[model samples]
Target: MLQRRRLLLLLSAAGCAQRPREPSEAAAAPLPAGISCVPFARALSGIALAGDAHLWWHAAAPRYRRGTVPVPGAVLVFRRSARLPQGHLAVVVRTVGPREIRVTHANWASGSARGQVAEDQSVVDVSPRNDWSSVRVWHPASGTLGVTVFPAWGFILPPRPADPAELAARVPVAARLAAGTL
Candidate 1:
């Protein structure tokens, strides 16, 4: 009886040791005040891709693979235009469907103080060609999708970590985000 109880306690302790750490400790650290979208998305994805948000698309070409589809942890890079002089960056939270995805980004809420971060917001691809070349982001302040369809450079799937299998076995995004890690 004593041996059986000892074995059971050991097993429980081992299981507890394998539990994942909270995002606040293991995930990206919180952004500093007045930081732009580029660093925010980079930190959120645990990726090292750098440069201005508008230039990430071109900069990532040699270092990371670019794609048109959004993946859960990929950074969506927006193109620079007259309205958006510097461009934008957001992390894809999930794929809502064909031509639609949910994202989390910082400093996007208009007229709100600077460096406002919105989580799990909606973005719809509106490119006429069925590609993710253009999108309309959910405007939190306006309470509606923005009338302007912003052009995107494309989605940049960040380089996978050294341990791909470990990433596959990690906790789901929703749970992490709810835990404030993502």
Candidate 2:
């Protein structure tokens, strides 16, 4: 009985040892099947924008703050291209550095991992100006930064105001006057 208990404990310990030790490692683990990146990013970031991921940047202009900076809870918008005709979106999980960020997104991988959510994946800014106009996403299958440089439209931040009225009220007097709303 004592030997059986010892063996059981060792087996459990071995199982635990196989678990990912860090968020990046966990990001490499395959998740269950998921929807496309648009819905996933919308739900995760609470941005509420719709349509193709490429359209999100312009669509967010009136409803949310859009910028080149990456912030937690913001949705990074990729541009439409030959490879990604509809583009892509990823919710910023954390800023790793001036040129690197960790994101949670979906549908970035191919094969069995395609359309599945990936969390804490690394994204590095590869643009020459460091403005986040282009980026290299981490490829879990290859366990490295992807070689293809994807163009990005920047990030759409969660709306600060609860309603349109509040947002209009918060707008600067100069800007509102210039736009002839004041």
CA RMSD of each candidate after superposition: 13.7, 17.8
Whole-model alpha-carbon lDDT for candidate 2:
0.65
lDDT of model 2 at residue 35?
44
**Regions more than 4 Å wrong, model 1:** 1-33, 160-182
For model 2 the TM-score comes to 0.71
Candidate 2, residue 171: lDDT: 21
- Provide the TM-score for each candidate, comma-separated: 0.69, 0.71
lDDT of each: 0.61, 0.65
Residue-level lDDT of model 2, residues 106-180, one tens digit each, is 667776654456677889999999989999988777788889899999989876413323322222331222122
Best by TM-score: 2
Off by over 4 Å in 2: 1-32, 160-182
